[model samples]
Target: MAKEIPQILKGFRDYLPQEQLARKKIMQKISEVFERFGFAPMDTPALEYYELLGGKYGEEGEQLMYKFEDQGGRKVAMRYDLTVPMARFVASYPELPKPFKRYQMAPVWRADKPQKGRYREFMQCDVDIIGSDSIIADAEVIATFDAAFKSLEIGEVKVKFNDRKLVDQVLTKLNIVKKDIGNFMRTLDKLDKIGEEKVVESLVEQGFDRNILKKYSQLMEKSSKGYVNQMTQLLSGLGVEQMEFDKYLMRGLVYYTGIVFEFVLVAKPEFGSVCGGGRYDDLLEKTTGVKMPAVGGSIGLDRLFAAIQEMDVVAPQTAAEVIVFNLDENLTADYLNMTTNLRNAGIDAEVVYEPSKLDKQFKYAQAKNMQVAVIFGPDEASARKVTLKNLREKEQRTVDLANLVAEVKSMLW
Candidate 1:
């Protein structure tokens, strides 16, 4: 047998203290923003039924799910995403009020081939609302997404918007789709990655006609409101168009019905959509026979953390404010008393390690980043006084025992 070794599986990670601290700070700020928008926090189990996992996430997502059969032959799978599980929750218990709003922060699993900024096990921050069919729901989701990105101080993000119904109308007009929606959609979704010429070639391979291609070529070229206005003038219907420029916004038929959108960072335009979601009017129908409308968005928390770090949006620095150096080892109780007092006074403090030489102890104190050192040596012990030294400023002061806590507080604060 080969030599035994210990290691985490591929596509998994171990976050050290500092790394976790940075990620937590980012999550905290995101939570505050979500709360301000009236989204209440909620949670669910990591394990759920295999039935609950099926036919919800997109085909690609289904392929990446971590599924298994348990000892009793019960089929189960780790939750793949928050949105589908949320849909199940609504159906399982329908007595909840309408327009349900909630935010979930949890880990999701995928068996994806991992690469830079992509992982098999990662966290997602999701916000969703149910039971509303108004356009304001669309507007509110867009506005909230904009606000969340803006609050995070991320780079300029343009949310490309579209409606699947509109695209279906266009495809039907072109006579390109009939029971081959998946392949056609997969081709369209690659429009961002592979250019238009190749997509046309692929469509031609599928036996789409020259006249149909030519007509839609003109349509796509009109990637602006001006073309939208022409479509409106030619047809009899109402639609919207604003700032329609070069946008790679087609994720092709992904369960979205009306008002599909994607959030992409301008810096690394090739990293693909950083966040994406759309309106799904028939989510809970799997759980409940009745159709309930819904809209939501997800922040690829792990990917965003890595990408933002590359863009130099640094996480906040979090460290202990003070360390209490231990001098006069016999006065250990006194040090503990002072440590507690400092904590009560709203200061982060910890006592330095001990039973070492005085010089070594000082070095250890410096290593632990103690700002102020208090000495209760024998001389001060006999005189009922304490010596406090400001390690940062190299200043020393002697104060009577009664005022030791107050004096230390005044100096540190």
Candidate 2:
């Protein structure tokens, strides 16, 4: 029989211990920030009925979704993002507290062309407020964005903000019909990627009057300048000043009805926005025929991890702080006892399963990034002593079994 090749899908890759550990730490810190703002945690299923998600995301988003027919012959789609699933969740639970606030960190699948900092399957950390229309709610979500990045210590970032209504107003002034507004907003969204000249050229090639598009460009510039609103003021009072209005920030989601925003690491602007979200006042209504105002922000965990890696943010490679070596077959029980004691004392400890040579065990401890190693051989066991080796500092000391926990704690600190 031929052996199957060990290869991952083209747009997918695996994360080894070091990368996964760092990513986990980043997610934990972001979760902490989310909770600080009084947001509770929630999640939805990976698959939703295809109709539940259809006509929600823009045309491009719909094309990027992984949709198929299940064995039951029901059309289902892998969740493209947390927000749409969240809408479905909220509509399903109408009894949930009004102004429902939730934070979800989970993997979402997209059949997108993978590139640097972009993946087909990636984690998204989302915080949303349902049933609230106050500008303060928008400010709260933006402030959470500020606090999250600060908590990660990922250097400085600037949150660029805009409103879908602003886009509507501009297009209205340009005499663009309501039916054409979505396409126009999508075209304007390309300004950052294709500069003003190319965007105008594309619009003109699409048969939009050159003079109207020229005016549209001027209106966007004029609108962005000196833009101040209740949302900005609320954010200011909340001490979230690392943000500005970006008229071109037309979030591609068709559900957005109001404010939209995104944050980018100021030092890594080339990496693009690591987080983005906005008010989608009409999504719930569309999903369940119940109108509820909602706002949310989502951190692209993969992009965030990539940015931090590029910045060399250090994270622990292992959760284990100490490794208890199995130095003697006869002392295995003793090593197990010590490991349990360390753990019970609120220390993360691990014990090798079998006896091994001292050098080999020490190398294993170092490879696992253990800060301390406990060595209890036949001799030490006889003396009721355990040798504590500081793997990081390369120092060793012998202590009584009674002092084993205390000595290891001191070494770790």
Question: Please, what is the TM-score per model?
Answer: 0.81, 0.95
For residues 146-191, what per-residue lDDT tens digits would candidate 1 score against the true structure?
A: 6677778876776666666565666676676567665676776678
Q: After best superposition, candidate 1 residue 325: deviation in angstroms? A: 2.1
Model 2 alpha-carbon drift over 4 Å, by segment = 1-4, 211-214, 221-229
Judging by TM-score against the true structure, name the best candidate. 2
Q: What are the per-residue Cα lDDT tens digits for candidate 2 across 198-229?
A: 98898888778877657876887777554556
- Among residues 3 or more apart in sequence or in different chains, the pairs in candidate 2 whose N, CA or C atoms overlap within 3 Å are none
lDDT of 2: 0.87
Give the lDDT of residue 353 in candidate 1: 56
lDDT of each: 0.72, 0.87
- The number of clashing residue pairs in model 1 is 0
Candidate 1's C-alpha runs over 4 A off are 1-5, 209-214, 217-248, 355-413
